[model samples]
Target: MTPLDQKINTHFPGLVVRKDLVRTVKGNAIVPSYVLEYLLGQYCATSDEATIQTGIETVKEILRKHYVHRNEAGLVRSNIKEKGRYKVIDKISVALNEKADVYEAEFSNLGIKRVLVDSGTVKTH
Candidate 1:
């Protein structure tokens, strides 16, 4: 461990989490390391193995309940289509069609394409 790591652990043993905890909890979430680490810090930032395990399960449960998988994005979109709104976690990209004078959005996860959008929208947000 680095000196800072050692120092952090020595001062706050339960506040620093193992690096692998992020990987263990991130199955198909496709999120950034900081985001996963933040989540782990919330529940599993401990050296105790048992507590870490419990925290892992807790994080997984939270992700399962909230995170959206790319494969299942269709369901979410369909829900929104039928019900007018739905929640989903997805990587979306948008581009400007200068020739067509419109904006196009593609939801890579949901496999949706050619979604017309406002030109004022930010790209790849």
Candidate 2:
């Protein structure tokens, strides 16, 4: 790591990610760049090469478990129903359903739609 990188890591630990590492962890997933960066920031935000490598593996495991793909939407939906609640990483859009008088969320990549959302979450996002 360079002096500047070391300084940045020292000043802002757990908030920065190396650009190259983002590509390493991304691995053909059709997710946003910010998503990878956010995951890397949480796990690999450090100048230590060893820790970064381990963090990359951890992040990969997390993506494997939580990230939803379009092809696997049905399985994920089944899992959610079976488990009652499940957390997933996917693109979501929320809009007010005027006819139903409720806020509905659509998970774009997951191919799930019309899931009811609370007003607080709708307004916050």
- Candidate 2 regions with alpha-carbon error over 4 angstroms: none
lDDT accuracy of residue 77 in candidate 1: 74
Q: Show the colliding residue pairs in model 1.
A: none
lDDT of 1 by residue, 1-125 (tens): 46776678679855676777777777666766775676688787655678778988887776665556677676777787998876554556888888998888887667888889876566424
What would the TM-score be for candidate 2 when compared with the true structure?
0.92
- Top candidate by TM-score: 2
User: Tens-digit lDDT track for model 2 on 21-125?
Assistant: 888877787768898999999999987789889999998898899999889999999999999999899988998999989999999878988999999987777
Off by over 4 Å in 1: 1-18, 27-59, 123-125
Ten consecutive residues with minimal summed lDDT in candidate 1? Answer: 116-125
**What's model 2's lDDT at 114?**
91
What would the TM-scores of all predictions be?
0.56, 0.92
